[model samples]
Target: MVVLAGIQEGKDAIVEEGGIVALVEAIEDGSVKGKEFAVLTLLQLCVESVRNQGLLVSEGGIPPLVALSQTGSVRAKHKMITRN
Candidate 1:
């Protein structure tokens, strides 16, 4: 998912297939590495897409992302705020 989120086309496909929620779920319940990867993938998905950013917040992505930011590594916290 992280690799797929790297390209615009891939990000589009993932979003079309509802990847955002999956990524959020991963962050909520995944392993340490998985959460980090999910965060990175979400960052890629939201980087240049305001629509995705809105969808992310609408789909309940931020709380867990914020939670991850609090408990995750410094790099993960960095990734979370970088979206701003």
Candidate 2:
């Protein structure tokens, strides 16, 4: 929840400081609420900075996000679309 709140407040450093990896892990393995928050946070972070987008792509963030888009909830898929 801290990550989500941080991202919402435009904290790219949170993502840069390994938060992206944790979020990706959550998308892959966390509960529904976790995945939702993770994806939403990532989307917000990516939207806030191109650097965070690059960081996400470089950290192998795309595949899991694509996977989540394919299999996750409607909101998750929507978040993925917004991220792109």
Candidate with the greatest TM-score versus the true structure? 1
lDDT of each: 0.88, 0.77
TM-score between candidate 2 and the true structure: 0.78
**True lDDT of residue 34, candidate 2:** 90
Q: Tens digits of per-residue lDDT for model 1 on 1-84?
A: 888888988999999999999999999999888888898899899987999999999999989987887898776777677752
lDDT of 2: 0.77
Q: Supply every candidate's count of residue pairs whose N, Cα or C atoms clash at under 3 angstroms.
A: 0, 0
**Candidate 2 residue-wise lDDT at 43:** 72
Error of 1 at 33 (Å): 0.5
Per-candidate TM-score against the hidden true structure: 0.88, 0.78
Candidate 1: C-alpha RMSD to true structure equals 2.0
Q: For candidate 2, write residues 1-84 as lDDT tens digits.
A: 445535445464575478888888898899988998898787777775788889889988899888887889887787667653
